[model samples]
Target: MIFCTYTSLVSVTHTTVVDAPILEVYSSLYQKYGTKLTCPCTNIAIAQRDFITLIPTFHQVCYSDFVKKSWLSYLNAASDKYLSSDFRSQGGLLFQILASFCRLSQDTIKNSLNKFYSTRFISNDVLDEDLLKNQSRSHIETYKSTTAREFVNSFNNIRDAISGNQLLSGFLTNFDFKPSKYSSEPQAYLVSYVSTVYNMPGRCNCDDTPSCIFPASINDNNTGHVILVVPGLYTGCLLVEAMRQSNLQCLYNQTCLNEIKKHIRSSVSFNSTALSSFVPSRYNASTDINQLLTELMVESWIENISHASYYNRCQPAHCVYTIVGKNNAIYIITALLSLLGGLCKVLYFLTLIVVKIIRRRRGKIVSIKFLVGMSEIYSILTL
Candidate 1:
């Protein structure tokens, strides 16, 4: 027993606080402590901008001449242009929708930023950089996914009402049809109205759905009943539908741009520059406008996050942890002496109890033997 030494474990805690720039603090704490260290934050509420940065790269169509007023108005004023999908009569509406889409996409993203910032964030800890990034990414993706789904439903409603119902036809009912500078005959105005508004003659009259409106060329206003399907551009029941399905793939080629440039009323030469699909974008040149709209017309989204910023915002008061430690020589010696004292008291009590029990049993045996001897002596005396 003298050769052996008594050992005991003592729990000890070490705490340290580093004062540095946000990025440096995060790097140092993460590298040194791994997960063993923790610091409770003095302030937990942090602005989202401190931890998250997101930038959306919009599609080239939004910036191209297609959406610009100069190009659209030029196409609209072309006297020789007869294709409605060429941005002639409905150019204003097309421009309106495109402009609205661009503005609304940005506004929605702004709202998302503000809304996310409004929420509370604990940061959990300073070293939880991965956790913070994942949260921000998830938040952005959720907004994008929700916006895409909602846009699809809303656009479908508009398309359905324009083609299958009389929802939009009522707006033109009160307007007087008159002769335009393009044509002296007021009847030409009527023909244009039916073609542009109803998409086809008698298309305005519908309980559930009107007749299908195919693309047509307006060589002469007198031929209202005739349907002409124009080549090189798409046209359907509504111009909006055509635009949604359209892409600038043709403008990429020299020949296609040349043919289309014939109708453009620009005095200057219109470049055949195409929308670039080579950039790091989720969509390609031939991707439909509707598909692009699903992504808010954003070619790409870039996110930048810094854990140092998060740690600074957290501003932990202290780092707290426990360490497994062996007792010192003095403490071990004291504990060993106390253990020996307790063991001695316990053994003494046990020995006293055994002796007492043995004495009581021996007295009982002697009493029984004495009673038997007395009985035997009485029986012998009587004999």
Candidate 2:
């Protein structure tokens, strides 16, 4: 069995409750500010950017507003209860109220910047840059990476819930507040949700173990169902945005490709027989007729004199027809001398025949045996 210990760490469960009704809050965030307006950070309008940014800002702003309103109201409610009744009687309740106040205060501050990003006359780009810096600073101050991530994650959750209506349905419980069946399932990033939240950067790797098992929810609403609905989209668009930046493409491809190259390099091996089949050539001065003929018989170059093989291999063929060597010159001289000797023998035979014919015409008897002897001598001369 392949035990996946890392898989256990994925899809972290988080729950938070706002004082307002969940549907009303969801609608206020999603419906009201979903339209593209002028950016708070820049002079350019929201229409110039992408549609994904538009809706998420809605959720961010709404959540931020909710944080402020809910926490204050919760505090006021606690104050009235404590002041109206005896403090001694309600001291235990006071602790609970104070604890709620602390939790909501932190949540409110986080939400405030996010809300501001979606609103008013400033540039979205500046707001985003500021938010990242703020988050980083907060992370340093708190010395808690997980909480720091949560601060951004909450806003990201809202982004996902809006982009994937199915995800919103899964994350948000019915008015009766029944836990969804998938609530126990792990949290993973959603492609469309992440695209909307992060401007369609790199893809989500939901199957990645351990990190995938965390329970996903928006504002800690419907954990499991929400993850299943939207996949890997994180809050704040930080991870996706970083990946989309041009400088990191090489690193991104390298990380994924290195594994394949490693397996190939490891499996390869050299074979001695394959190497031994090829040998380097050495020049030979001595020429043996038998060896030359044997080599010519088997050699592809000699057989492919018309250079058919050169075309097959996509090369230009230019054969050298001249032979230059001491022994080669001797053979050429011998052939030339032999041709002259044969011509001389033929001329001497013709002269002798004419002389015999002339003598026979003058009434002298010609000797057939003598003629035959002369013919044999000419043949020898020809050789």
Q: Judged by TM-score, which candidate is best?
A: 1
| lDDT (Cα atoms) of all candidates against the true structure | 0.60, 0.30
Instruction: Judge candidate 2 at residue 321 and give its lDDT.
Output: 18
Per-residue lDDT tens digits of candidate 2, residues 1-383? 01122233234333232232232343343343332211222123332112112111111111222124443343334232222122222222322332333354345445643553343232232122234345434433343234335544554565455434423222121111333344324664323322222123344332221011121112212242221211221222222221111111111233322322222222222111111112221212122212222221111111101112111222212211122223344454565567668869998999899888887875433576678889999999999
Worst 10 residues of 2 by lDDT: 297-306
- TM-score for each candidate, following the candidate numbering: 0.63, 0.17
For model 1, the local distance difference test gives 0.60
* Model 1 deviation from the true structure expressed as Cα RMSD, one decimal place: 9.4
| Model 2 local distance difference test score | 0.30
Give the TM-score comparing model 2 with the true structure, all chains together: 0.17
